[model samples]
Target: MDRVEKQAALFNLPETIVPHSVLALGYPAEENKEPRESRYEENRVHFEKW
Candidate 1:
């Protein structure tokens, strides 16, 4: 097994505990902007119409 796999086994962790690239596929590449700000703006606009 590889080094990471060996360490995980030694620590009694499941094989699925490693980070998955798919989890980050949807994040923007730009680091200077906050994604949550846009989401909060959208929610605010939607609630204001009700």
Candidate 2:
């Protein structure tokens, strides 16, 4: 909190608007590679009925 506050204060930015909660961040790691699946083909809904 202290570090973030100090940095925000230096920039003269509002504490309320300062992004304190990081949504997502991480180092790159090996992931299982796979072909992309089709969404429209599987979950198709007609205009008046499925």
C-alpha lDDT of all candidate models, in order:
0.47, 0.54
Q: What would the C-alpha RMSD of candidate 2 be, to one decimal place?
A: 14.2
**TM-score, every prediction:** 0.30, 0.32
Regions more than 4 Å wrong, model 1: 19-50
Which sections of candidate 2 miss by over 4 Å?
Answer: 19-50
Find the candidate with the highest TM-score and give its number: 2
- Candidate 2, residues 1-50, lDDT tens digits: the string is 78778656655665465635423545458775785575556454333322
> How many steric clashes between backbone atoms does each model show?
0, 0
lDDT by residue for model 1 (22-49), tens: 1223655678654454434554332212
- Compared with the true structure, model 1 gives a TM-score of 0.30
**Cα RMSD to native, each candidate?**
13.5, 14.2
